[model samples]
Target: MNNTIKILLAEDEPSLGQIVKESLETRNFEVFHVENGEEAYKIYKEEQPAILVLDVMMPKKDGFTLAKEIREENSTIPIIFLTAKSQTKDVLEGFSHGGNDYLKKPFSMEELIVRIHSLLNRVEKIKDVEKIKIGNYTFNYKKQTLELDNISNLLTHREAELLYNLWQQKNEVLDRTFILKKLWGNDDFFNARSMDVFISKLRKKLKKDENIQIVNIRGFGYKLMC
Candidate 1:
């Protein structure tokens, strides 16, 4: 999977796009470069790349719109947004639109390469784990799916990671700071809020089984009592 990783890159600027494509190719990544969001979406539907690098200000569909659409189809694929806007609102909006990471414009190619490698490494780790059993559900780490009876619920990347951690430490109080740092790479306020959102989502998904409960430990973290 190292040399076979496929990346879909969408950038409006011709020179920048070419440079990025070349740089990634030199790193042994298979890249499909497109000039606009419309082409990006079309290629994405056809190829289903492992990761996405989208420029925010595209001609047709726009990066945020493309990311939302792609996310609806595939929740686990990592999305990295490129934009010149550095406002907090814009960054949060990118995350809300299903972006896993954000890169400001005029960024170094080396930085992009490092970010891609880090995300890919994290994904590889998730895929290495075997299926986990929680209450009445079977959690497939690789697929990021929770199956019960004949119904299956697919989880977002963050949801799967958070649930995986809790499942690993079931019946024990897992620290909030530890989870935040492990999952988001930070314990900042915004990331903490994001962690809360994923926790709520996991609880709702696990509610199908009355025997399973994710209890929050006040001033601590959470305990998954199965």
Candidate 2:
């Protein structure tokens, strides 16, 4: 529950890294500053920092490769690349590797701070929004809090995602295969069991909303009907 903004900074230039780290620290960002991409990756894995500020040209693993590895584990973490290469190809590659923002070398510290704050603000807004209402229940994906009319109920993460998907496909029979692929990343038996647990949780949450029910189509999939 320690929600402080954690930043992982990877910069090959010693002086610039020191300056950037000091500046970010002044602005209240908890920083783990590393000299190269290798150390950056190590710290990133350990800390799971919220924001990654990476340098493109670095020793050990390059920034693009590091970003790709990070993306594989978590698709939503924001990345910012600092590079001297301002070529169109380089910029395209940075974005392709999952960089959320990029800063050209010799950029002002003030501009960098502004960009970081902007990205953090966007993430906060996404997390702070209230539940989304569908049929008779409110689905609070952030808190995993589900409510039917006025009664509040707790939901696990997977359960919330399942209910959210059902809400998204209201009145339509969502294919079993599609839900499995989208949410579990596969349609294997283990994931199928996970899906069952979530379905049971959703059924309990929506019990009061008698009109809103999740109906199983057996051998096919399910549907959220109101």
Best by TM-score, which number?
Answer: 1
Q: Compared to the true structure, candidate 1 yields what TM-score? A: 0.75
**lDDT per residue (tens digit) for residues 129-191 in model 1:** 677899989999777789999798877666777788898899999899998776565688877
lDDT of 2 by residue, 104-187 (tens): 888999988888876666556555656688666787866657776577776543465577778778888989999887654468
Total backbone collisions for each predicted model: 0, 0
Clashing pairs in 1: none
Candidate 1: segments with Cα more than 4 A from true spot: 1-5, 13-30, 45-49, 68-76, 83-98, 104-110, 128-130, 218-220
Give candidates' CA RMSD values in order.
Answer: 3.6, 12.9
lDDT (0-100) at residue 171 of candidate 2?
A: 89
Question: What are the runs in model 2 whose C-alpha is more than 4 Å off?
Answer: 1-3, 127-226
